[model samples]
Target: MAVIPVALAGRSYEVRVGSGLLADVAGQCGKLLRKQRVPIVTDSNVAGLWRDTVATSLEAAGKEPRWLVLDPGEGAKSWRVLERVMDWLLDEEVERGDHILALGGGVIGDLTGFAASIMKRGCGFVQLPTTLLAQVDSSVGGKTAINTSAGKNLVGAFHQPGLVLADLATLDTLPVRETRAGYAEVIKYGILGDRAFFDWCETEGPKVMAGDKAAQDYAVTESVKAKARIVAEDERETTGARALLNLGHTFGHALEAETGFSDRLLHGEGVALGMVLAARYSARRGYISEADGERVVAAIGASGLPISIAALGMDADGRKLANHMLHDKKMDSGTLPFVLLRGVGEAFLDKQVALDDIAHFLDEQLKTA
Candidate 1:
C-alpha cells in the first residue's frame, strides 16, 4: 500500500492506494470527516459490485449512510441525473456538513462531487475509486463535471474530495476491455513527463496488466504521486503546468465525440489512439522524429490498446473527426492547442496549430486508413 498526499493547503487529503483500502473506509476517512452521518453515493453497477464492502466498513465506524445508487455511464453525469441525485440527498435530509461517500469509478465521483458542490454552495465528499483510471487520475482531481449537449464534461465544478481511497482488489471485477483501457492513462503520465516511467511500462506493464499486484500498486502510487504534484501546483489549471495533464485528451476528446462516448470506444482507448495520432502529427510538424512516433504507437499496441485511427470504425473522415476537436474546452482564443511529443517522454503544448492543416492531414489519414 502506498499513500500519496495532495497538498492543497486547507483542502489537502491523502490518497490511500492498496489492495483492500476500500474495507478501511471508516478508519481512514474518519480521520478527516468527523461527522456522525456520511452519505454513500454510487451508481447501480458499482453498488452491485462494491457498495457492501465499503458500506460495511463505514457502518463499523457507527456511521449508517444514505446510499444513492444511480444509472451508470457518462450519461449519468448530466443535469437531469444531477437534479435527481440532489433530490435524493435532500429527501434523505443530508446536511451540508455531512460527508458524501462517493464509491465506484470516475462517473460516480464526478456526479457526486458536482452534486455536493451545488447542494449547499459547498459540502464535504470522499472518494473511493474502483477503476484504475479513476484511482490514478479523476478521483484525485477536483474537476467534477456533468456533460452537456455541446460536449462532454462541459458543465461541472471544481469540488475536491476530502479523501480518496483506491482499492486495487476491486479491479478484478473489471471487464478485460476496461482494464486495458485504463492502462492508457497510466501511460499518459510517462509520455508527459517521465521517460524512465515509459520504459518501466514497456517492461513491467505486461505484469501489471496480467494482474500482478506489485506492479499495479507501484503504477497507481507513482502515477498518483506525479499527478498530485501537478494538481498541488495548479489545482484550477490557471498555469500551463496543469494543462500538460491533457497529453492526449485533445484528440482523445474528438474520438469520444465521434463514438458518442459509448462502450465501443472507452475513454482510455480513445486516449491510446489519440496519443499515437498526436505523436504522428507532431512528427509531421518536425517537432519529433518518425522513430519517436513509432515508439509511442508500439508501446500502446504492446499493451493491447487500440493505437490506430482505423480501429475506431466511426464511419467518418479525419476532418469530420477533427471538427469534434473544435468544440474542446481547451480551445483558447478560438484556437486549440495540441499536446505533441518531441520524444518518448517529451510532450509540449503546440498552440500554433492551424485548423486547415489539421483537416488536410486528417483527410490524408482517412484516405490511407
Candidate 2:
C-alpha cells in the first residue's frame, strides 16, 4: 500500500492507495475503532459489491459493522436523505470517539462526512471511497456537503476524515463510463499544475483506464499527492492556492445545474466538457495558444469524455449557461472567479472576468459545437 499524508496539524490523516485495502480495512483502521461497532453508510449500488467484504473484515477484527444503505445517485445528497442518515446514526448511538465509515462514491462520502461533521457537534469518520472519482478527488479533500435548492454544495462543511482507504481494486467493478468520468479529474491535476504529469497522462491514461494496476496506482497516488500538498497549505480555501483544484469546476458546475443535476450528464462529464470550454476561453483571451487549447480537448476526448456542449443535447445558450454560473460558490463580492488556463498545466483564477463575455464566448461555442 502507498501512503500519502494530509498534514493538517491536529486534523491530519493518511490516504491509503492499493488493492485489497478494503478487505484489510479492519487492520488499518483498528487503531481508530474506539468502539466495538463502526457505522457504515453506503448507497444501494455499492452495497451489493462491497458490503460483505467490509463486514467480514470488521467481523474478523471483532468489530461489529452496522450499515445503512441508501438509494443511489445525486438525489441521495438531498436534505431528506441527510435527515434519514442522521436519524440512523443517532439510533446507532455513534459517539465522538467512534468513527463512521463512508463506503461508496462522492455522494456517499459527501453526505456521510457532512453527517459526521454535525453529529453530536462533531464526530470522527473514515472514507472508503469505491468509485474512481471519489478515490482521486472527493475522497481526499475535506470538502463535504449536500445539495440545496440554491446550488450544488452550497451547504456543506470542511470536516477531514480520520483515514481514507482508496482501494484501486474497486475500480475493477466500475462501469466504463464511470471510470472515464473519473479520469477527467485525474487529468485536471495535470492541467492545473504539472506539465510533466499532463505529458504522462497523454501516454498512460488509456492503460490506466484499461485496468493496468501499476498505471492506475501511479495516477491515483500522484493525484492524491497533489491534493494533499494544496489542502495542507490552504485547508479552508482561504488562500487561492487550493482553488486551483477547481480548474474546470466553475464551468462544470454551471453545466451540471443546467442539466438538473441528473444522470443525463455526470459531474465528471460536465467537468470534462468544462475543461474544454475553459481552455478555449483562455485561448480567446490570448492567455494560451490555440494549439494548447486544442491539446487539452484532445486529451479529454481520447479518454472517451465529452469535449463539446452539443454532445449533452441541452438547449442552452451562453446567457443561459452564465446564469447558472451565478450560483457558483466561487463568487466573491458578486464577481464570479473563473479558473482559466494560461496554457496546458497552467491554470490561474481570474476574478475580473465579465459574465457577459462568458455568455458571448459560450454562445459562440454552442453554435460551433
- C-alpha lDDT of all candidate models, in order: 0.85, 0.92
Q: Each candidate's TM vs. the true structure?
A: 0.97, 0.99
Scored against the true structure, residue 142 in model 1 reaches a CA lDDT of: 94
Tens-place lDDT digits, model 2, residues 1-369: 899999998988999999999999899897898878889999889999999999999999999999899999999999999999999999999888889999999999999999999999999999999988999999997999999887899889999999999999899999999999999999999999999999999999999789899999999999999999999999998899998898888889889998999998898998898899999999999999999999999999999999989767788898998998888888889998888989788989899899999999988888776
At residue 264, give the lDDT of candidate 1.
Answer: 82
Cα RMSD to the true fold for all candidates: 1.3, 0.8
lDDT of 2 at 49: 99
lDDT tens readout by residue for model 1, 1-369: 678889997989888888778788788876555666677888888889887887788788887766778888888888898899898888877777777888888888899989989887887888888888888889987999888877878888888888888899988888878778889989899988899999999899988788888899988999999999999999998887888889888888888988888888888888888888888898899988998888888999999998767756668886788788888888889989888888888888888999888878776665544
Give residue 294's error in model 2 in angstroms.
Answer: 0.6
lDDT of 1 at 350: 86
Q: Give the TM-score of candidate 2.
A: 0.99
How far residue 7's Cα lies from its native spot in candidate 2, in Å, is: 0.7
